[model samples]
Target: MDRRTLLTLGLGGGVAVLALGAGVAVRQVMESRRAARVTGTKLGAPFRLTDHNGQPITEAAFQGRPSLLFFGFTHCPEICPTTVYDMETWLSEMDVAPEALGAYFVTIDPERDTSEFLKSYLEPQSHRILGITGEPEAVWDMAKSWRVYFQKRPLDGGDYTMDHYASIFVLNARGEVVDLIPYGTAADEAKAKIAAVL
Candidate 1:
């Protein structure tokens, strides 16, 4: 190859790398800012809901232990499962005792995500995570209290999908939300934050 052509190709490759790096940096910053917005804000309140088993469950049930709470519907194609798995893996790596750590999956779409649906949907999680759902008003009230953003968008075939906050609420043992852990957090960082609560 000619010297000029070789140099140009090298520069193009460098530009691509720089562009990718910049995109990553920007995303990290955005996620950090989003996390900051929700942190230091008192979250979670006394709210009544039901678990995937059709039994009553309350927010106070998470008290006496630090908990990781995520608000998403089971129908989510990617983000919901990915976030749950990531959080679960982080918890496992931290070696958090099941008693010391309460992990919950709260569904924002209660209409379609019935108790049976949630039970089957999370069966693969080995039942490690508890799924919460209830009447629309009850669920939405809990989401609003937690300041979680979620909305349902109708699909083509009379079905719908849920868009929700991708961050997990980190609650202290007293059940007070102490931090917002953003999606894709470095596992080491996640472990450190979770360990502090444990």
Candidate 2:
């Protein structure tokens, strides 16, 4: 190629690299701002639901303590289990027992996650966490109020699965969402967010 043409090509490549870098930086900043927006936005609302124990409860039950809430179904194969494990691990390292934080394992699939099923599904949690499930309408009300995403999809042989937001929702002592702990966040990051209000 001619000398001028070669130089032009090199400069174009450099410009492309710089533009890509700028785009990445912009995305990072936007993501941070979005996280902060969700943090400051009020979330959670009143709902009377049945716990794994089959007792009726309302949002009032979770009042007066910081809560680490997760919405997933018992039948979830991967994301649900992984997120729960991460949150449990993060809280295990906390000086406070996980239960003290009012941990909740709310099932978004009420049709399948009956109170009896929820009891067995959470047995591994050793009663440290409460599982919430009730009528579909009540569950939808709770999920909708929090802006949590959840939808059921049918699979082969008439089976189905739940698609939901898997992040761990952090509520301050008064039940206002203060931050969202993304799934797989570093333990220190989760701890810092929880500790800030504890």
Candidate 3:
């Protein structure tokens, strides 16, 4: 190739690389902003739900104490049960007073997970963790306010299952989200995050 043509091609390639690099940087900044927005979101939206004990509860209940909030249903074949077990283990290991850390399991499948059913489902897992359920609209509204994503999936025999966000939310006394411990996080790491909020 001619010298001028080679020079032109080299310059074009360099410009392309720089443009690509700039695009990547812009994308990274946008992602960072999105992450900030998610973390800055206020939690504890208004809702009236029944606890496992059939007692009325609201967003007010989350105030005045640090909490570990998890969203799942009793019928989950794996993640839900495993997370419950992990939560129970973490709380036991932390040795925190029961009243000190309010651990809750909010059901996204309220259609089938009633207050009574939740009581039975959670009893074996850990009394330390309470279950929350209510009318479908109210339950889903609460979840939506917290940015939880849950959708129903049809199964065989006309049954249905839930696809949901499976993470433990650690919140401070005022119910502001401190950190999210994703499913299958290391026990020590999860405990550290929970303890930080507490």
Candidate 4:
């Protein structure tokens, strides 16, 4: 082959290689971002609480499976139940085995959400949807450890309202926090994210 022809071919091959490398890099970056959006953080501090059955539960209960956790009270009129319902629907649609995942509802209003109340309230939900509550001090400590915010507001009828942060925590099989989905996360998106982890 002529020298000029050989040189041209070499340059063209180099350019193609570079283009492929660039494409791969872009794809990797996109995938990372998607994973981050689906799973917020990868570390979860330890926590201990009482299950709806009044049994002592801890992060240990979540070992060997991914846990979808949310912090709210049974009395929450709108956001709490709606988010739980969405998670339930999304989890039901997932192809994961039943033993591969769990759902936990941690109550911020430990004062009002007794074991009996939680059991009655969550009866209609899936059995996988476990409810947890504990002493107010311990519950608050756990909330802080999870970086969740909550407060109590007084009402005029000699009652009170509890306002708590609303975010879904996704934990991996080893009981480590992997990601967080906000309250408005779409059902399809949640399912896709969970499927990715599974």
Best by lDDT: 3
Find the candidate with the highest TM-score and give its number: 3
Model 1 compared with the native: what TM-score? Answer: 0.76
lDDT, candidate 3, 42-151, per-residue tens: 45578999999999999987889988888889987777888889999998998988899899999999999999999999998898999999999999999888767677
Q: 76, model 4: CA deviation in Å?
A: 0.2
- Clash pairs for candidate 1: none
What lDDT does model 2 reach? Answer: 0.71
Candidate 2 residue lDDT tens string, 82-119? 66677667677776675468888888899999999989
Could you list the CA RMSD of all candidates, in the order they appear?
10.1, 11.6, 13.2, 16.8
lDDT of 4 at 139: 84
Least accurate stretch of 10 residues (summed lDDT) in model 1? 9-18
Clashing pairs in 3: none
Candidate 4, 1-198: lDDT as tens digits: 664442221322221111223223334544676676743243335777899988999878778888888888887777777777887778777755567888889888999998889988886876768898988898878876666667787767898766566667777887656666766677778787687667
In order, the Cα lDDT scores of the candidates are: 0.71, 0.71, 0.77, 0.70
Task: Report residue 111 deviation for candidate 1 (angstroms).
Answer: 0.5
Q: How much does candidate 3 score in TM-score?
A: 0.80
RMSD from true fold, candidate 4: 16.8
Q: Against the true structure, what is each candidate's TM-score?
A: 0.76, 0.77, 0.80, 0.75
